[model samples]
Target chain A: MALVELVPNFSEGRRQDVIDKILAAMKEASTAKIIDSRADPDHNRLVVTIVGEPEETFKAGFAGIKTAAELIDMDEHQGEHPRVGATDVVPFVPVTGITIEECTELAKRLAKKVSDELGIPTYLYEAAATRPDRENLANIRKGQYEGLKEAIKTDPDRKPDFGPSELPKAGATVIGAREFLIAYNIYLNTDDVEIAKTIGRNIRHKNGGFAYCKSMGFATKPYVQVSMNLTNYKETPMAMVVETVRNEARRYGVAITETEVYGMIPVDALLDAAEYYLQLNGKWNRSQIIEKKLTEME
Target chain B: MALVELVPNFSEGRRQDVIDKILAAMKEASTAKIIDSRADPDHNRLVVTIVGEPEETFKAGFAGIKTAAELIDMDEHQGEHPRVGATDVVPFVPVTGITIEECTELAKRLAKKVSDELGIPTYLYEAAATRPDRENLANIRKGQYEGLKEAIKTDPDRKPDFGPSELPKAGATVIGAREFLIAYNIYLNTDDVEIAKTIGRNIRHKNGGFAYCKSMGFATKPYVQVSMNLTNYKETPMAMVVETVRNEARRYGVAITETEVYGMIPVDALLDAAEYYLQLNGKWNRSQIIEKKLTEME
Candidate 1:
């Protein structure tokens, strides 16, 4: 058994009935554990998080897309967040006993299912992209719901990897596979936001920092914060990023006030932190964790 | 569905057939997980580790004891470790949703069962002790098997808590409840044994240090280590212990090399370290961990 995480973003956040119906449909269709469902009215999007076997997650994700298509009209949808479909984007992340390539296969199966059954064109992005042009989600969603509505029928470049090259009432969906993203924030003692910004800039990928990190600085009320989205915890670990932030803060005569993990995070992240901070010399296996051995793979 | 860990020590480690029979009986009798079983020939003892619901664990541990009694004759048993019975001692430790008091009750039930049914005398120690004199395990086994045989029939001070005054072929069994013992060792960068010994002394309870810590210094092949048995992790956490060692090592101008956790450890121990070292300001609950939420109470 494998544990794969699926985070599906739907374009109907303000309407509780629509989200509930979609959630109920997902719960009915799949055996996956629906861990969380968050709706932001400002973004007008509902994001659901689940952990289960790859096939079970696909069944749940497909149900969500089908239900969203039936209830949400893309033309009527308006929000601060960008969208190209009622079910905007769905990503399959490998949790345990599964590889990224395997998740890509699961993503492909989900895209084909939504496109064929719902009569809505679907584009594969990220690891599951059919072409180099469709690799980035920003590329697939370059044209919003209204723009893509016209482009899909005409432009060969705008054509989806599945279904007819025509957009329906639900519009086009972008589905793919990606690593788990950790929403981590580090708070600084100083009131100065400049120091936070500098550390953020030096530690984010675009500025020749850690490869899989995207960070920003903010002056949030009581303390300055260096907020980050760690894209690949295995490649660029949490401990290294934190230690770097600590060392950088010391140069400015400041210390870390506290830290925050914004949402649900895998146990491995904390276990990794334990190994590094405690200076465990790779003398133990993760199986030695009694709870882990007892837990069956999702 | 409370999780309780039971570690049972039997007096025959040199005989593989006897150990196998005991393990098989426990596995067949109880719907509980037998996570580990270690045999130390020098001590001539077998220690089996189990984690399950209180009743299920008690059934499994009882099965092991019954099997050990039938196979091992204590009069012929000789070992480096102190023992008064074929199934020397069994200790129950609380894992999750289970209290020490509940475990003590389970211990008492096991003690009474072995004594009444098996016709072997039983003594309670630690949290399950009937009297102040029986609180220490060493006090209960003051006269090993050979000496305890005559003492049990003659001396009032050496009387057992349960069963007849006459000794059986299997001898006496000791049962009780105690906190989980983590065999943790911290290695220093230097070869100096004195620094390790001093740090060990300052951190152990017997010398007026951390309440539940028991430590000793050892000069292993590569490093001088402060070997420890942390009796209660909730009160004296792993992060606090390691940090204290780091702080103490600084006084001797030595740095820590690495640390080791000898065997099975509860996931909470590592999570405690992560929360402290990462400086999470009570902003996150352990329930927020995806794995923790997915796992049943056990």
Candidate 2:
């Protein structure tokens, strides 16, 4: 089956009633399954994860965006995380039997629909970005809600690819397609947050480290963490990252406490590491998995 | 979905027409997918693998057995491999969301139906065996067709589990349930068969080795092979076996040339090894897989 994963972030998280209404509308409007939903009071935002065929996923995404636009007013929103709209960011990821190009097209279609129908401006980022300047989401969401509200009226570069030039009460949503991202974090034995911050800066892509990694360091009580997003596991696998971090940690006289996978990951990402460590000879395909064959039959 | 895998060995493999007929009948019978089929001319047997929901899988397995019994006659059968019937052995395996006990129940239902409707005596072996001696398939298939033909009528212990004690024209079928078995083989750098034999003896369960392994040694061409059947992967995983064999081979001044997995394997088997090698902290699950979540949603 052609499967796509949709992960969208909303501005409201402190209120359960609004979150429930948006979730209810998403579940009712499309056949896609909402696998995971997290509401963080600190971030004051909600992150919802869903997966299904492209057509159904698009409809579900649109439904959630519509509900978020109706229920949340960005003027009243406050969060620890960056945001530009009530429904902040919607990213389409290729799961199985799907291509990045196909996901890009799906993102564009959803962006246009949400913009035209909901009167919410939308910017395409990542693989579906129309302009080089808007390729990265952080770049498009540079000013946040307040700054973007003024910039949209004065700057031509700030004008969205779709919807009216003026920002609506719901603000603007950033929609795009990208490869599966693995949110991995490794904790250090010592409670030195500075050590973690130094390692994170040295290993992240933006700081000239692994090509697809974005990392930061955080102090969470007992231990310090080198938190990261592996944007493309195929490019820089889990083992390589873990080992590099381990070697880097040794310099600070600290050991790795443990590593964690934050969310759902594609099977191939782990299988690739398995094959490498096991030294499996020759070629092995996913068809060799009984469940994979069963899924294909379905 | 409740998934069950059926691997049936048919007595007639030399004749293409008969094998094709049985294969076609199996495909037409139910929605179960035929994953693989291999006809061994020397053994004069056909091993067909199929997997689906329990009900449909049972129907397809029955259809294949009925077709094999119709096209094959025990009186004229001759082969290198030992067999007691036209449809020699049918093993039901639990693939996903199903237990060995559930598969044992499925095997018994298939056995009773085949015995009563087709007038073919059936013996339940392995997990579904009524007698301790019948638990091992090699023991149940002892004496072959010619020897069992006379013994079933005389020996009380030889009486079939279902149908009449006397053998039919198609002979008797052996049906049962068992855990997924992994057939793995390792080739040694040296051509010394005795080294391979000694290692096999040391690693097999019967010789006080790993509890779930059954191994043998064979000299094929330039290398000697240590062939094994891992009956229960959860008990004795692939990494443990490979490491054991590697340690044993070092004693003989021999290195492992390569290792191979024979057929389809459960994803958990490899994932288990991945976790051990990677040292993933805390509890990790198949739910972390995007495809697994998709399957669950279905």
Candidate 3:
């Protein structure tokens, strides 16, 4: 069976009871394994990472979005992070034996179902975008919940790919497909946040650094950190990024204390790092990894 | 399912039909994946790698050994490698969620079945060895087929562990349990075979080097190679070995060209290498690896 990773963002984060209900509903609805569940009180959002076959993953996302729409009122929603609906954004990532093209199709179907049944408008972003303008998530979420409320009815440019121009209290949800993202963070020796910021700006794609990289520096107490999101690890590997950061840190006379893989990372990403560090070549066959061979047999 | 890896070595490798028959009988008898099957005509031996749960893997090994005993006459077998039986040695390695102690139990059961049903004397080696002297396979296979035939009837120390002290056409089989062995090789920039040999000796356990490592140097045409078998990678990781070899090559002013992973390897071995090379700390969770998470759910 093909494996797909679905990350669904919901508006309710602070309320443990509400979050539990939504998670439980989704778990009961599908056979997918919810590998990660992070509820940030500041962002006022809950991000759930689920892995399973395409059909079950789609079901889990739908169930989660449906539960969130019922519990959360977008009209009263407030958060540190920008969002558009009760179930703000759901991105489907290709995990094993699945392609981006296939994930895009799955995203389109989820968008249609949400719009049809929940009456919550959906905007397709990234690989599933109909127009080039909507490919970037920020472009689709330009106005947030308040601005999009009026813009959806008046502005043709703000019209979603699915559902009516008007939205319910739940608001519009951004649905799409993207490559596996590696959340990597490099900690600096000193507590100077500005130094970390300078290094992050130099190594991130937004600042004309590595492509498919989004990074920002944070004062994470004991050490200043350059937190990064590698949107496409296959094209822009973790090793190249870490080495570049190492070089950048050396310029400021500040050494990196350590690096952190913030969440569930694909095994290939780390294997890439090992290959680069060990200077291993063609003789090493990735298929020879026992677990991978067992997966093939399965 | 508790996964076990079984590597069975047979006496006949020159005859394709004989090797195919032995392999076919094993596959037909059990539902195990025959991942690697290599027949070396020079050694006149066939080594087959099978992966499956305990019971099925036991069935597969037994079937292959039984077929090999029927087809291969040990008295007529001659090769570069040492051997005492048509089915020389069968080693059961714990792959996933299984301990060496548990694998020792499995190996003993298989040895009993082989000795009882086939009447071919068996001696347990490695982790399953009854005596400390038999812990090393080289000690058990000291005299090969010719010497073992007479020693079995004469010497008390040469008595079989499982069956009668009488010799059969198949001779004796060494059955045992051992940790997953990683077949690793590193090639150097220069074709000087002695440089590779020195490096190999400096890093191998047999020559007073690293623990759980067996290594040698070979003149592998384009470049001299340092070949190794890492018996217990959990204790002595791949990163430590690779880095040591890299440092050793530096002394001789020779650079490492590349390294080869000769056969199937456990995922944990590479992950340990990645963690070391990447300088990744606590934030990374091995359980978070998507494929591993899927396997855990299963």
Candidate 4:
């Protein structure tokens, strides 16, 4: 069976009734399974992680997006995280027996459906981008909801890849296809934020570090951390990131307290690190693993 | 569906026709999938690894065993590897949605079918053993095919667990249930067999090493290796074994050239090592992995 993953970010997080209703709409599809659903009240956003057949995942995502649009009003929406619409970002990730191109096609198909059926403007970003500028989600959502609404009227460049050159009350939605992103954070023993910031800048791709790594420094209450979004773990790997961060932080006399994986991670990301660390040569395919073989039987 | 794995060792391997007939029987059972099948001419043995629903696996295994028994004659069998019968050892492994107890039950059922219908005397070992002494497979087939025929008649303690005391012309079949075992080997750069033997003794549980590890020294052509059978990877881990061997080999000015995983391994084994080496903290559940989530969707 072909499996694809959908991670849809919703505007509502604090209200249980609204979240439950949106989740119910996804559950109503029946074919897809909700692998994980988390709401950060601080971020004031809900991230729903769903996995199933491509068609089933699309149906479930669409239903959830429609339900979110009905329940949320972007005009009154306030969150620490940036957003454009009730369904902020809907990304299609190829999981198993599926390719990135297939996910891109699914993303485009879903984006068109959202624009035509739901009367909401959608912009294709990442692998599904129609324009080079739309390749990065941050660039596409540069103005957010309020700024994009005004910019759409005056600037031709602000026009979305899908739908009319205007934003609805629930605002605009961004749809795209991308590899699975691993949100990894390594905490330092000291509260010196500068140490983390320096390490983050040195280890991130934009600042001359690992090619596929994007990093930033953040203070989460007690500790300073190097928060990273590994865009392509196969190229850079999670272990290399952690090791480099550890080695860099040591220069500032900062010891690693612990590391946290914020969301879902790909198995290959972990397995690649294992192969390197163990120095295991010869044949060591994931399929050879017992647990993986058992999963195949299932 | 609950999944169980069966690894059956057959006495004949030189003839491709015999191997093909056995595999054909397993292929005939639609529900069971033959994950791997290897024929070692030096051992004159064929090892077929299959996984599927317990009932389907048993049906397939029974058909394969019957085909093997009919074609192979113990009087004509000669091999480099140890053996006592055509279908020497049939071990049932609990894969997914299946417990060890359930595998034990399946082993007994297979043993009964083999003895009743095929006229092959069966001895249960490991988790399916009726007597405590018969739990170890090596102890059951101690004398191999040549000595077993006379030994089974004279020795009361060496009697078959299921069937008549006398060994059939096809020889006695040893059937049991055991945890998945990973056959791993680490080759040293140096041709010093003594160095490999010393490192093997230091890491194996029987010789006061890791609890779940069994080690031995072997020379394969140009390389001398520390061959190990990890009975429980969760307890001992593959990475720890490699590290310990590497550290020990370093004392003798020997470096590990490479490592080999002989057969199917569990995904958890690799993941465990990755987590340890990477120092990834917090709840590291397999459910949080995208590839695992994809498999769950199926």
Candidate 5:
């Protein structure tokens, strides 16, 4: 069976009650399984990870979004992370036996369902975007919640892809279909933030690096990090990004202390690296892996 | 959940009715999923692969063996592959969240169940063997079906690990637990079988090669092959084996044209090679892989 992964980011992360309600709604779609869910109080974001059949995932995502919209009031929400609605962003990632185009179709169907049923304004980003500007989440959410609400009234370009022109009290929702984004962070041995920044600049696309890489520098306690969002792992692999960062960091006399996978990552990224390193000739199929065989048994 | 894979070899392979009965028995377990099942008329053997929760796998294996015993008579069975019973050899392999020792325990338990219920004599080989002599399946089944039954009367060393003193008309069964053996074959561009044998000898453990590698040379239609059974991939990785074969084959002016994973291989084996090739520093966790995330969702 084909598997689709849904990562729904809700606005309220501080309140356990709000998070529980949204999770319960997702669980109502029994066919879908909750892989991981985290409520970061600092970010004030409740990110719920789920995977299942495409239909079940769609039902679960809609149920979770509906619950979040009812419980979270955007006017009262406050967090370090940017948001435009109660259900801030919902992304459908094609996991197995599915294509990106198919996921885009599902995203559109779900967006239409949310607009018609919940009266929530929705803007499709990434692969599901109707407009070129809407192709990026950063572009779609250029203005924060309050700013977006005002821009919708004043700016013709600010109108959402779905729902009314005016944003509701709960605010607008951003939904899309995108490849799995691996939030990878490579920590440097040195505490010098400048080194991290330099490495990030050298490897990130914005600074003339890999096409599918987006990067930034951040400091956390004893270490400085080159935080990266692998936009398309197939186009530019996680290993390549890490190696580039390593090479750039070496020029600054800094070594990689460790790396962190912030969230979920796809298996293909690892398989691609394996094929390259092993120099395994011909076509390599994942089904030959014993773990894959075991999963199929399940 | 812990996964245990059962790959059972049966004496009969030419008859579809016999293969169907064996597969049906495996399906009867419900939880055990048949990953791969093939009947080789040339080899005159049926190899069935199934994986599931340890308990479910045990149940399915027992069911399949019982069905094979009922349908196959060793006295009338003939196979090119070495065998001594209807259910020739059953090897329990640990895949995920399980240890080889745990699989060995499962193999012992399953062996007892078969002997006690079906009155089939069973010999434990590999990790589950009580004696060093019975550690190898080839050593245990040296005499094959016709010879082993006669040898059991006089040869004190040929005694069965379980069941009655003599082998039944269906023959004795070999059951054990072992580390997952990845049967990898690298086909060379040149059809010189001697070059393949020389390379195989240079990389195989028996001839001062990799510690966990066992290799032989064989010819298959269009190419000469360096057929290998990686006993412990963790110790000597698949990539290392491939590289060693490649380097050795170059002495005879032969290039490794392609490689084939004969059956099932653990994802770790491939991932290790990827890490080496990619030079990916820090958090290179299998859990970060996308396919693994999907499986966990399941």
Candidate 6:
């Protein structure tokens, strides 16, 4: 089975009832498994993680988006997190036996469906972006819902890939296909946030570090964390990044306290590291994993 | 879905047509997957590995055993490996969402069917052993086919678990449930076989080593190998065994050349080592692997 992961971010997170309604609608529409759902009251945004076959996951994502659009009014919605729609962004991540190009096709087809059926403007971002300028999600969501409302009408550059030039009460959704994003946070022994920030800066792609890594520093009560998002684990694996952080931290006389894998990660990501440490010198694949073989049988 | 892995050893490795017929019979009988099959000419035995649901796997195992009994004449069978039947042994390994007790029940049920339907005697071993003496396979298989044939008529202890006192031409089968076995071999850089034998003795269960490990020394052309069967990976993990061997080899002024995982191994065996090296100290489990979650969804 070709597994695809859909993470749809909705703007209404404060109202639990509204998020529950949308979740219920998604459950009704598709056979996809909703693995995780986090509603941050501060951001007022609900991020739902669904994974299944491409068709089912796309349908589930659409159902969630439709429900969010019906219940969440973009004009009244307010959150700390930036958003341009009730269904802010839906990115299809290739999990297993899937390609980014195939996911991009699913994203584009869903974007057209949402535009035609619900009369919602949709912007393509990341791998499915029609225009290179709109590739980054932040670029497409540069202006907030209110700002985009005015800009969509006057600014030709701000026009969406689908739907009317004018924005609707639901606002515009940015849908695309992208690689699996691993939200990993490595905690340092020291309480110094500066050390974390320095390591993050030294390892992030933007700062000429690993190509697929985007890192930042965060301070908790006990320790500092070098929080990272590995956009493409194939290009720059999790272990490599962890090793780099460990090496960098050693210079600051700090050690890695512990590492946290924030959400569900692909089996291959961990298997790669496992094979490396074991120095396995045989033909090994995911099929070797009994559970993985069960999925194939299904 | 609960997974049960059945490895059926048939005493007909010299004949390709016989093993093929047995494999074909299994395919026709159940939906279980034949993950691997090895025919050892020296042993004159065919070890077929099938993994699936308990019911399906049991059915497949019976079909293979039945086919082997019909095709193979055990009286004429000669092999380097010890055996007492055409279908020498059928062990059910609990892979996921299953227990050893459940597998034992399945083993007993299948043993009864084989005895009653096919007229072949069945002896339970390992976790499914009826008596304390039947716990180890070697204990029951001590007399081999010819000796067991003569003993069954007179010796009360040699009586079959599920068949008549008179031994059939096919002989008796040992069926039971057990943990996943990892056939791991680590080669020492030294040419001396004594060092390998010494290391193997230090790591084997009988010699006060790892409780679940069964190790022996083998001379393979240039280097000596510490060939081991890790009967229970959960009790004696792969990494710990490797580390022990590494330490032992260092004591003899030798180093590890390479290691070989001879056959199919469980995912947890590798994941345990990966987590140990990575120091992943958050909420981490096998379900976090995307493929594992897919199995749960099924």
TM-scores for all predictions: 0.91, 0.86, 0.85, 0.80, 0.87, 0.85
Question: Lowest-lDDT window of 10 residues in candidate 2 chain A?
Answer: A276-285
Deviating ranges (above 4 Å) for candidate 2: A14-21, A40-44, A70-81, A116-119, A186-209, A214-227, A245-258, B14-21, B40-43, B186-202, B206-208, B214-227, B246-259
| Candidate 3 local Cα displacement, residue A91, angstroms | 0.2
- lDDT (0-100) at residue B238 of candidate 1? 89
lDDT of 3 by residue, A8-97 (tens): 999988999999999999899999999889999999999999999899999999999999999999999999899999999999999877
**TM-score of model 5 vs. true structure:** 0.87
Compared with the true structure, what per-residue lDDT tens digits does model 6 show for residues B133-204? 999999889889999988988999988799877667788999999999888888888789999999999999
Interface RMSD of structure candidate 6 (Å): 2.4
DockQ of 2: 0.54
TM-score of chain B of 2: 0.88
Report how far off residue B262 is in candidate 4 (Å): 3.1
- Worst ten in a row by lDDT for model 6 chain B: B277-286
> Candidate 4, B181: how far from true, in Å?
3.2
Candidate 6 lDDT tens digits, A51-84: 8899999889889989998999988988899999
Return the clash pairs for model 6, or none: none
Provide the lowest-lDDT 10-residue window in model 2 chain B: B276-285
Worst 10 residues of 3 chain A by lDDT: A277-286
Cα deviation of A66 in candidate 4 (Å)? 5.4
Q: Model 4 — TM-score against the truth? A: 0.80
For residue A147, what is the lDDT in candidate 6?
91
lDDT of 5 by residue, A205-297 (tens): 887899988888887669898888887887888767777777888888887777777766666677777765554556467778766665555
Listed for every candidate in order, the interface RMSD values in angstroms are: 1.0, 2.2, 1.7, 2.4, 3.5, 2.4
* Inter-residue clash pairs, candidate 4: A288-B265, A289-B265, A290-B265, A290-B266, A291-B266
DockQ, cand. 6: 0.51
Backbone clash count for every predicted candidate, in the order shown: 0, 0, 0, 5, 6, 0
- Candidate-wise lDDT, in order: 0.90, 0.90, 0.90, 0.86, 0.84, 0.89
True contacts kept of 5: 0.68
